[model samples]
Target chain A: GFAELLREWESLENEYQNTQETHQLYRQKLEEVSKLQESCVAAITRQRKRLKDMSPSIRKCKQTMTSEEANTMEEIQALIKERPNIFFEMEAFLPKKNGLYLRLVLGNVDITLLSKQSKFAYKDEYETFKLFITVILLLFAFTCQFLVSNRIVDVLFNFLLVWYYATLTIRESILISNGSRIKGWWVFHHYVSAVLSGVMLTWPNGKLYQMFRNQFLAYSFYQNFVHLLQYYYQSGCLYRLRALGERHNMDLTVAGFQSWMWRGLTFLLPFLFFGHFWQLYNGLCLFRMSQLPECTEWQVVMCGSSFLVLFMGNFFTTLTVVYHKFKK
Target chain B: GFAELLREWESLENEYQNTQETHQLYRQKLEEVSKLQESCVAAITRQRKRLKDMSPSIRKCKQTMTSEEANTMEEIQALIKERPNIFFEMEAFLPKKNGLYLRLVLGNVDITLLSKQSKFAYKDEYETFKLFITVILLLFAFTCQFLVSNRIVDVLFNFLLVWYYATLTIRESILISNGSRIKGWWVFHHYVSAVLSGVMLTWPNGKLYQMFRNQFLAYSFYQNFVHLLQYYYQSGCLYRLRALGERHNMDLTVAGFQSWMWRGLTFLLPFLFFGHFWQLYNGLCLFRMSQLPECTEWQVVMCGSSFLVLFMGNFFTTLTVVYHKFKK
Candidate 1:
């Protein structure tokens, strides 16, 4: 019995020692791998910098070159263009500096993507969050339109919008840092939306607010519906295109239209245009209210200007995208 | 001249091709390294699971063994205790699931630390942010006490506190995932603080609010000062201990006392105990206000209970830590 017990004990101890050794070996290998990743990232960054530095000189050299030299220059330009794609796969390992928005909000905290999976997961979360919030906002607007006329309820809704847009802007910036191809205007759009909602939140409960409140809620409902439509349609398009190897996986579904989304989405054009015009109508209504003799709140004029800006940005951007798609 | 031009073009072409090749080679290596990292992490996870599964069996085996076998069992237990340390350094490369708080707030977004530097940087940012916000809160409380008594201002101040605590909780969770050894009660304390601040934010502007506003603001001012003091002293002690190799580098400075912080930090006990008692005092005040005939807001009783909970949790935890340290 003693011999059997000792054998079992020895076996367990042997297993424990073996597991410890294996763990230590893997730990050491992981450390080496981490170091190698760091150096590889550094090398890639340095190479990118060198290519960037040489680009202007190459362009200047092209001006005076023979035809043969021009062909080489063109090849060099093409290579440079394709360079980022070659290294894009390793971006998660690269050292990233915080963009201005992140620096302002989160200080110098590094929000670099650690792996490709985390990046995609974050992007998906962003999409789901946008979709989910759009639904909630639509419902809130519906309630505000029909059920309650309380100023407190309106203020709460406006605060929610402000908070939502603020969070969206921050998340979008992080997505951008992780190589999401979100255009600059969409990010700017979220910032403006946050400011607009914040202004509405501070708008005093008075004649002008009441005059514009119903219209604003109705417009919000319509806008949210359009946003939901765009998200579903655009994400569907992106998914198909990504699957077919025609679109970047990092492409995001934007609030406004883009040229790449034109293949089979013609039926959705009318809704987008109508929403844009509704924004224009809102701007006009607010401008009218701002001129009223009883209008004392600066929020009225501010909101009016913001609406006009949104209308112009959305309408023109959508128009440009459509025109370019037709021309192509 | 033509030959020289050809030569220059060829040299540039060569450089471009060489850069491209180097990039490709490094990219391939990085991919392999990433794969290695994944497998290594998987292995570590598997090993940890195995050890955990074997733990109960080992304990059972210990009770029925001879004295020599018991000594062997003790060795196994000690090895198990030390195994986590061996693998701790590789945690950044490990797959981390979202904690409950992060899951509820941010969905399933991955907040894993990618490297040691980022973890330390994020920890430092958290400390600096806390320090910065504490100063701002202290000033706001001072203004609320002597300079301003407007309900709107008070509401804004309370909202800031709510936002601050909410953010701190999220950041602290991230830090915890990155291997910081912050105790559980501190995180729970922030949750309670966020709730308290939110309840204060929603308390209506009324006679009861007016009665408690000054006292709350005064308590806030003192609490912030004590927080600032604890931050400075605790961080100083942690810094010394960490440098001396006597403390884990990921240790955080908490709002209340910790056992390891007893050396040369006896002076801070009064301030911490005073703050804890002040929470009790606030709880009592709010209870009195809630009992008044004119009081109708649910916020009063809710805030009273929250303050009492916070006081009890803080006082008992600190007392236990102190008692254990002195016994040692």
Candidate 2:
């Protein structure tokens, strides 16, 4: 019980810290971009809404406009309606006297960029390979963990599982930016999984955030491996059999090998995370609980409740998900 | 205070156990995928549907082909329909399976060229610029967490904000892969807030993840500035500006500058996180409690919440989607 409590505490603290840090960061950044001011709220809302009503219909005359052009016009019109309210909203907060004149001069200026200066990007090769390996390994580890039920194994895998997700979350966000979409369930798969990471890694210190980042160098090998495997599969591996084909060079090694390694790494996390969790919980519990000199029964009970919750809420969810996954 | 408790839980334990070593790495590597076993849930469901459709059209089709051919056709059709379900569902478990499977396999299984293999691609001048300025800065102190918040001027500028984010999460992940995205948002008053990074990074991670990731990089330069200027305009900085232009590069420059200097090299985490939160909360209570905190709280809360929800739910959805995608 002592060891388990310690383990539970460790997880709770780590998770708490991570969540706190993340929330703070989000608050700060979002503040940076927000342009809301109280004074103009009423006016801006009224004016903007009025203008929105005057805009053209979506169906069009079917007459003389393309949907694309109509859509563009609609967007521009929306902005136009929003402009007055936006301006008022911007104005509401201005000191009534400010370089009042300076304010006027500044307010009328247009500031859209002619071209974007740059785009942000990150890289993660290991994460890439790790993900592949995770998928494959998860498929395997799911079975292993279910069979063994080792807490340590659960810790390692779960930790990596969180990391793996962080990687995937970032990947899909980019894909969405690039227009990765699905018609109904046909292609909507990418959008759902990110939520899981969103939930699991939503901690205080932002460790998961840090861990979830792009590890391009590590991911490179994975990309190469996948490409190579796909190519090889498409090319047909080197089977120099008699009349099987007019053969060309087969360069299918990178992807196959990459997948092999990636899968191995991916599933390994659960084992690693769980093992780590178990060891920390066990040794610590055994050592600490046995030597307690003066502890209240209430404290012990609370500790026990916390541990049970941690296991059921976090570890159990992870294990169960991993379990059913492998069972499949 | 009540809300805070609801928002997060402070775990009792601080140390995590190391249980990642028990599983044999070799088994993961050697699991040969032979006869793939997937559940027949889809099959049974389909059979039920087919039995229900005893319409004239169904009878006509049944009469046109041999039983064996018809059976084969149905199987193919079922397989085709089930393709998306497999990919989408599979992706949820993928990270644990291995890694992001992006590597392209070449013919002969020998050569594999990944799009991200060329890390940092020093081969170009523009990229070289990114490497020299942003990249280098990121590695040393990363988003400037190295810089502690102190002197009014330093605090006002939020000098280390860039360094903190770039380093802790963005840069570190990029370090692993060598991919990045660089884009910026232009604010009013020729104020261009260019939110850009270096490369697309790689898939074990990517830009999408980073954008959605909520983490505290360092002291808020904008927040600091907002504080100094709060008296200037009752509504804060937004009200102060008459017409915010987006043409100038000043915002980008301001966003990038980071200061990691502290009176001493204290880790600054507790001070930065808990101390600041406590201080802020105290100050806000001095006001109306709802005034200051609410302004920024929503963003932080929303972003964190969205991330959490998306991370947990999206993966499951993606697995089925990816499968359908590949199958199609």
Q: lDDT of all predictions, in order shown?
A: 0.74, 0.31
The estimated TM-scores of all candidates read 0.79, 0.20
Docking class of 1: incorrect
Q: Please give, for residues A94-155, the per-residue lDDT of candidate 1 as tens digits.
A: 54677876654555555666556666677677778889989999989999999988876886
lDDT of candidate 2 over A76-172, digit per residue (tens): 5554644654343243222222132211211111111111110111112323444455455444354433465432333233334434444444343
Computed on C-alphas against the true complex, the DockQ of each candidate is: 0.22, 0.01
> What TM-score, to 2 decimals, does candidate 1 have?
0.79
TM-score of 2: 0.20
Residue A191 shift from truth in candidate 2, angstroms: 7.2
Off by over 4 Å in 2: A1-131, A134-136, A139-143, A182-328, B1-167, B171-328
Scored by lDDT, the top model is 1
Candidate 2's DockQ is 0.01
Candidate 2 - CAPRI tier? Answer: incorrect
> Model 1: runs farther than 4 Å from truth?
A1-93, A103-121, A136-163, A192-220, A248-260, A277-328, B1-67, B78-93, B103-110, B114-118, B139-163, B195-217, B246-260, B283-309
| DockQ, prediction 1 | 0.22
